[model samples]
Target: IEERAADASTPRAGPIPPSQRSDMVGSAEGVTEMAFDASVLRERDFRDTRRRIQLLARLPDIVAGSVDDEELLVRVSDTLLRATPSASAVAIVRANVPEPMGAGDEKPSNEHPSKMKVLHYDCRENGAQQHSVSSRLVTTALQRRESVLHLWETERNGGIEFTAAENVDWAFCVPLRSEACAGWAIYVAGSRALGSNWKELADDSATLADRLGDDVKFAEVVGSLISGIRQTSHFQQRHLAMRRFFAPVVLDALSGQDPQSWLQPRQCDLSVMFCDLRGFSRTSEMQSDQLLLLLEQVSAALGVMTRHILDTGGVIGDFHGDAAMGFWGWPIELQLSDPHSDLSASAHVVASVLAAARAAAGIRMDYAMGQTEFRCGIGIASGSAVAGRIGTVDQVKVTAFGPVVNLASRLEGLTKHFGVEVLMDHASASALQAWLGQDEFTEEPSPFRLRKLGRVRVAGMKIPVDVYQLVVPSGGTQDLTDSQIDAYEQGWDEFAKGDWDSAYQRLLELPAWDRPKDVLLRLILQHHRIAPSGWEGVLDFPK
Candidate 1:
């Protein structure tokens, strides 16, 4: 019966197939002589044909409203009931399907067929009966995977009527099957004798069910795609927020790794650089108009330094008044325990800061009584430290915590005492030396010149640390000459060997602008008289 109903459907461009049409007409040839009235059949056919036209006109609306699944299903149920002749109730139930099968999969078991969730539309006074009958019809249609029609007459109070639900005498249950969904659509109508139109009604109901199934499946697919799109959009927004707080390398690593794990504190080897304006405090005491101009110049200088740091894949940790702190090898394993990477990063940072310092020194503002020679100091240190995010949720910062951070800051402060513009610890200096040693062209003059200073124990440390000055030749702005560097090194060797008088004479032979020579002169004057015992020239800061 289901197959015949399916075959009855013809393309809108042509009439039904001749053979099936002839068979249907021949089966109803003797309708007038049957037990049931023929007029009832004729009237049913007329009404069903009209209702089908109405349903077809509204089919597009039902399909187009598929963005909202619940709304679309409700409208579909209502339309089915309207098109079904004399229907007292209608129900639509979606099938519960397991995962899609693969080629090698065996047939799935139906022992625990999914429960039916029926959407019922009750037109009669009895809602409970409508629901109960709908459930049974849905289950039957799913079990058979076909259309099921039942007709019965109940003798109640001398009148024949169906007694199962609202005295319905006829029930039509058809499975809604499509590539995207499986379900059932059930229609129940009151008792009426139909001599010939019963078969036609069943065929029409089956056709409608099949076509509607495809539409519903398409709607479901569209809805699922929309949901997935929304979820992806949300994830992208969160990723952008993470980018705001973390460096690009860290963000890339976190993109593949877990963000929660990356946020936790960990011990890592890092290179930290601290840069501060040398005379910002004194400059700040000037009149507001002049102070504003000076600050603007300072900002421009920092911008240049910032580009250098970022270009070398460094992360700007934070900014203090007139100063900036940045670091490398964090959030992700940037340097990866490689000394060369640390040295390269530190060298770049020092070069950038020195360039900014040089630019600041030439600031010519009318308010400057003349050209204001602004000087800056950059201090770099490389070692292991604890790195991660810190502070409350509302105001968090990504930075490192350890002696490396402290020593870097202290080194920046010492740049003034040593009369040098750029200073770094032994680790950075050694790494730079190793990196420079790899250079094949020794005659071309190395890109950077490294000068070792005497050992010094800063205010907070128990052991002394060796410091070095980094100098880069600006564009035609002549750095230390080779001869001058040689002389300074020889003098420094003398000073380290405890020959203060010889060191002073050798240092005096170099240019007076040399910062190391200035530092050695100061040290000699301070310790010439009170010679402390076992003093190996390790300068200690006063508490």
Candidate 2:
């Protein structure tokens, strides 16, 4: 056997057969013919020229075959045997060794055992009895990093002779290079049925073997790209989950910080808001069998509230039976990024919650025909609280814990008693006041109208807390008329000073639309009761 490069431009011994002239194997039917650069070539050059033509006929199949890798390699080996005619069997082996598996300072050696598997082949009757080439020779060819050949002959006395094998008596091994796997392919050819020209067949086989190496590399690259895309998709899903529960500015900061450190439990200054639908229990009981209808009405009302809250950069914490809890200024710093932004964040929280409450109160649904419109009450508080993750590992929830949250809930409950839609504790009320008092805010007419409700010590609290009532208009910033504001404050001052007779007469003189009539009415009823001896105008509500 012999090995050498096949000249690319050469004429075949005869016209290529119709069966082998398919487009799959590359069409040679066109008119262009190659022109040789040299004149007067030698005998060996002529043989190389002929060998090239035969190999070129099979080029298209190897490069663009529709079949899989195994089938493509089998076709290459079978084509080589067909070209030789003297060979009757073939095998296409795949390399299977791990690449660079050693530890530090360890180097690989040539003596390492070769890992290989047969990809495809054609075995003839006599060829099945013995291997045309031994595995050791295959390893030796790989170590040498090139093609090597061996030939033997049967002696007249029935003993084998160590002579160069002719067309029917040779074995050859060719290395197929690839970085994807640390091994080489072995093509074993066997037979004894022809005149000669074994050297040309060996040369053609070596050429096809090299191209096969490239095919393996291409597969590896495709596999790697798919893996990378899948990993990116997973990260995107996690990013979306976090975004759903936090604001964009928070996420921006979290991207650079370590989650393990920030997620630990700690105290943080935050503003918490709680909103609940008033008389929802009675409403649900009335629409008992039509739960779906109730859900549609409630969802429509809540959807508006949710959108406004999210727009204001508030993180929704939990959605209990008929209420939603939300907060701001935790999991990250709440520095004033802009001039108005200092109080704007808290102001937004109040405005959004009030807007939602008003919307819920005014919603009219077809399913609730003849029923009264739904109304919601909202309460907001600002203070320091312990904030962190809670629940089991698999289903953890991020939430805030402390009196700040509890007070917000209590304030929501007081909305019904005060006959108001929205209420807030001192911290949040102060922030709103600061922004509303600004020139920018005063010039535009504030989005909210504030009323100072008298101090009261709520249940479970030692200190009396100052509360305020907020009136949010339906569309834009439109404060109440002067008469409406004057009437409520005038009546409140007299009531708080314990002058029951004057307070009763002042509230009685104001028009019904001057303010919420219930506030004055409730005060008149309480006015007749005897107060505790040390009362400093603070109402004691133990419930």
**Candidate with maximal lDDT:** 1
**Per-residue lDDT over 339-361 for candidate 2, one digit per residue giving the tens place of the 0 to 100 score:** 54656455444544444444444
lDDT (C-alpha) at residue 193 in model 1: 27
Q: Give the top-scoring candidate (TM-score).
A: 2
Q: What does candidate 1's lDDT look like per residue over 1-543, in tens digits? A: 111111111101112233433112111110100011123222333334555556566676664556555665566556655554445566555555444335564432223236666654545345445534434334444454444444333332343322433545445555544423445344344433222344343333233323233323332233333334433454667678755445565566667665567877788878788887766777767645687788786686565456556555566777887887777777665442346454444444343333433433333221144434355778888888887776786987777789988888888888888777678899877766766666453667676777776788998888899988777554443467878878887887778778878888889998766666887788787888233568677877645
Model 1 stretches with alpha carbons more than 4 Å out: 1-254, 287-296, 335-374, 392-394, 439-443, 475-478, 527-530
Candidate 1 residue 214 C-alpha distance from true site, Å: 12
Clash pairs (backbone) in predicted model 1: 162-167
Go through the candidates in order and give the C-alpha RMSD of each one to the true structure: 15.4, 15.6
Task: Pull out the clashing pairs in model 2.
Answer: none
C-alpha local distance difference test of each model: 0.56, 0.55
lDDT of 1: 0.56
